[model samples]
Target: MLLTKFDPFKQFKDLERSFYNYPSNNESVNGFVPIVNTREGESAYHIDVDLPGVKKEDIKVDISKDILTISGERKTKDEIKEEDYYKVETSFGKFTRSFTLPENIDIENIEARSDNGVLEVIIPKKEEQNSKKSIEIK
Candidate 1:
């Protein structure tokens, strides 16, 4: 039988399990992880992403079926002479973020814009359906 009770400790259990699968420090990973924030409003969903030092033209946003994808590359500034740099910490590379949009979204009405290194994607929700009809008994 399936248990219907909700356990408050489930989150802690999941976090403990994740610790066992953590990546090693020596892993070779490319690109920086752009911070992303998503919020739902009364009529739409807003996705805010931070892409510092990346150009607007370099970014691409597309929707395939119900999946929304955002991709871009941050090119490193002109190569610096080996002796000219004391320390380089800024990350520059390609990065992509994708999301599976829900059925409530109005796909045709989605829009994206960028300003001051911030990208905003607005996803409008479709009007709710209310077409229930009473069937006349024979």
Candidate 2:
């Protein structure tokens, strides 16, 4: 006997994806999706993307219309002899990820850097301005 976990909405999700031609959150159109982690701090928000085989030059970060997009491609080895490999599981393809910037973010100060195969995007929040004012009526 085999026990399997069941999800009642799995069928509905599949139907929706097929109807709308959309990829699931964990799957990308190119078939390679880099894992990402996000954190929010008092003064800034950080997004960390794990890209094992992708080079820094291949990655691109851009912002347009309040959307931050990260795109890159992972290239395979120059030559691979099929006979020499019993199994190859490495994924290679183009990948894209996007995030919507919050209204309180300081767009001008956004920064991105890559180190040890991790790409970190830092979005600094704008300092809050005191809006309280005294109004005198005649």
Candidate 3:
């Protein structure tokens, strides 16, 4: 049998090159779902999303059939002169994210607010089923 030598450094270099050369689509890409932390309470569910560089007019939130969708676009500045020499590494494009709310949520009472680059969504629980309680035996 013939033995072949494996070069790990060469493989890593190829991976790094590929990462830098990755293509970006001009259309919106829903790659990152917001960091969601669900807390069980007697009244409602609160969701917060970190959305820096997004303007109030550019953000859109929609709800349909128990699904909530959030989308926004961050415009890039065009202040770089032709003679300027430097590196640019900031991302500028459209992003979208969606989530399906549980059945027990009250769709009509859902509310959203944005302040200081953070978005907060409040989903009130349904009164009929969410308010029901069960007795536990010890």
Candidate 4:
């Protein structure tokens, strides 16, 4: 009779199990909050977020007390019938994100749009008081 050596991969099997069986994180409960990148210019600030599998109708944008909130839900597709299965992996759920706008932003002019799974928000800056000035040299 021959004895085989123990495989090292078996030792890490529990780690793999934990990763696969872990519960959803805090973000999942808040909806599919995405990574947001903000760009500031003299005229406006632009915010971009990646949101795949989410529809325009499912998204909701609200502004209250200088706070901007974006929330949406992504519904999972129905199961496909198949005799032979190889692999399947995808995430689908709700998500919400909020941002505190600067005091100089014009909340009434804010606009948001989703294109090709990316959400873009534009916040126009408030007009500066007496921006135009004449220079006098003595």
Tell me the alpha-carbon RMSD of every candidate: 12.3, 7.9, 7.3, 6.5
Tens digits of per-residue lDDT, candidate 3, 1-138, equal: 999898869988998999776656422144423344455568888777777767889889999897888888766666965347476444566777788889889888888999998888888988874666889999
Error of 3 at 45 (Å): 1.6
Indicate the residue-level lDDT of 115 in model 1.
Answer: 94
Candidate 2, residue 133: the lDDT equals 92
For model 1, how many clashes?
0
Per-residue CA lDDT of candidate 2, range 1-138, in tens? 999899999999999879776656565556678999999999999999999888999999999989999999988777976677888666678989999988999999999999999999999999999999989998
TM-score of 4: 0.66
Per-candidate TM-score against the hidden true structure: 0.73, 0.75, 0.63, 0.66
Quick one: best TM-score, which candidate?
Answer: 2
By TM-score, the better pick of 1 and 2 is 2
User: Model 4, 1-138: lDDT tens per residue?
Assistant: 999999889869978888876556533433455667889988999989878778889888899898898988878665864434475344467777898989999888889999998899999999989978899999
Per-residue alpha-carbon lDDT of model 1 for 1-138, expressed as tens digits?
Answer: 897889999999999999878754323267566889999999999999999899999999999998999999988778766478898766678889999999999998899999999999999999998889889999
lDDT of 1 at 130: 86
The residue pairs found clashing in candidate 4 are 31-94, 31-95, 32-94, 32-95
Q: What local lDDT score does residue 24 receive in model 4, on the 0 to 100 scale?
A: 61
